[model samples]
Target: MLPNNKIPEHLRSWSVPWPLYMPTFATPPELQPGPGLDASVAAGWAEPAFFPAVNDWPQRQAAALIPFQVVGGRPRNPSGRTGYTGRRLGRWGENQAADPIVTTGAGADRRVLLIRRDDCGQWAIPGGMVDPGETVPAALVRELREETGVDLAGYRAQILTTTYVDDPRNTDESWVVSTVAHYRLPETSPATAGSDALEARWWPFADLDTLLVAVADGGGRLYAAHRRLLGLCGGGR
Candidate 1:
């Protein structure tokens, strides 16, 4: 992907294959991170309510690091544009999210953890943004706890995959990279709905495909990228 492609005017909003663009527009003032915009500040509009105070994160670990160019003092999506420019999203450049694929039960009774997101009301893997100065694994653990109240205290996580997510919420300036990790749960581990989740539960691995295909048909919407990640899990495909 070219670094400075201009974002097309019409090919935005969940384009099947996102359009290529060299960003030529200036970033709006509200999206720009200023002095007080650190880890706790909201950026631009309010739908995405939890933008970090600071967004000047240096290169760190992520599933994929998309090459970007500065367009009007902001990192522009290099692969292409998603049309909407930071409409409801928090960060301007890369928003790193980590998902923990926690599982329990054995064989036929096996199930994987899932959380219903408060924003989109879709069943999704418990995850959240990577805070600055935090390692990817630590961020994964913290986000998992904040969203689902599941603690993988002594569990060692194996990174399953790292890749750029085709998030529906992405815009020309905002994109996401997801790092998915596997964490097997002890038979006794407990999970409860917490933080930004509306509900938390384990789903039988056998039912994963049905759920993914039915996401838009009322079964439940799974976050775009998450659906793909779940396919990598055993039987979920």
Candidate 2:
């Protein structure tokens, strides 16, 4: 579901300006298109996948609309091209991402693991795109390990929520949907920054408000979607 208030800064449209209105441009050479298996052959949990120009979004109560028409046979970003077009996110239209909130300790000592994204330099719960054939839970575990070196394979996670990601890269054609899950880390879990992260660290739940962020001219920080997700998980500043 869309946020009831203003879109969060990180997910707000950052597409470059176009005359009259912004339009999403093609993916740059450096960025590969979003990853996925062919829709024609998708099996099991991947059966319902939406492929570019291959499958139309199903008519159902659960499906969300993109609010724009297709361009070049691809979904068009309703808002326009984000500054980095396909640089970070590969696909347009319903990009699937997941976040795993790994917490450790308890009471006043409770802390959550966060990673500084290499591209944006902002602290956020570790997350990434879901490859075709992967379930949301599976993707969450894989992404958490890839970014923060935390193993959640044996941990029990609760599905906190699934909602549209207010990612700055969203366009009329491309937007993100994310599934957020939570896991209380074991006492022995050792987290190290890896993969797409610049650093990994644990922040006390009580001190979330004090952490400095790189977004909004440094006056505001924390990935916007994550801030909201954390709220739903009962973590508040």
Candidate 3:
């Protein structure tokens, strides 16, 4: 069972603005931190060492220094209030992720590879969390292979952008930041869905504007975060 972070009774009314409305929630059991807590710390909580304020971590590609203020021993989400405290995310601070944008053809004829995510059932670029000890470039390649069955390790990839994502899973204590890379292929490549992806397929680059408009209007099949990530890839204007 997961530990619950319950909101106070006084704060439970629907009249409360969403920013002020704290919801009772528990991090999913599967995403719970491992049993690595210090002897002095409580069980089911992340170790203090993982926190930026607790440790002097040198900035690296996999873990960039996205600033966050620590309050009551927890990192505060830099983007502002996210209702509840504690984290629905696995990490206590910045969760690093990598996105790979693979494309073929050029200009009007270009097509990009995308995957249908099992979690949200939205079509998104093939990507995943950057694992411990993995470089952002390596994570990009690995995630591409795992989600789309594309092997682009031999091809040159260009780093497009690295920025904090406005993911729904973000909380007051944890949030996601990602590095996006672009891989250009001379021709179409074979792609098969695997890992957390339900399906993988190619999409016309020109259609991204339409997709982005639909997503912005709140009725699209594209993942929310990917809308921003894809824009960094020169898509959707």
Report the C-alpha lDDT of model 1 over 67-163, residue by residue, as the tens digit.
Answer: 5665445555655565455433555567778888988888888898888888777788898777666788998899889877878889999898877
Best by lDDT: 3
At residue 163, what lDDT does model 2 achieve? 76
Q: Each candidate's lDDT (Cα)?
A: 0.67, 0.64, 0.71
In model 1, the Cα lDDT at residue 157 comes to 94
Candidate 3 TM-score, true structure as reference: 0.74
- The runs of at least 3 residues in candidate 1 whose Cα sits more than 4 Å from the true structure, single-residue gaps closed, are 1-64, 213-219, 235-237
Regions of candidate 2 where Cα sits further than 4 Å from its true position: 1-88, 212-220
lDDT of 3: 0.71
- Over 95-209, each residue of candidate 3 has an lDDT whose tens digit, in order, gives 8889899999988998999888887767888988887778988999999999999899689989888888877677666778888888899998889999999888888888876
lDDT of 2 by residue, 1-237 (tens): 122233345454535334444333444333332343333224222222234434553421124333445555555545544433332345546677888888888888888888888776778889998886678889999998899888888889998877777776564556777888989866736779898888787877776665543344332357665777777765643
Better of 2 and 3 by lDDT: 3
For model 1, the run of ten residues with the poorest summed lDDT: 44-53
Q: Measured by TM-score, how close is model 1 to the native structure?
A: 0.71
Rank ordering of all candidates by lDDT, starting from the highest: 3, 1, 2
Measured with C-alpha atoms, the lDDT of residue 13 in candidate 1 is 28
Count backbone clashes in candidate 2: 16
TM-score of each: 0.71, 0.68, 0.74
RMSD of 2: 7.7
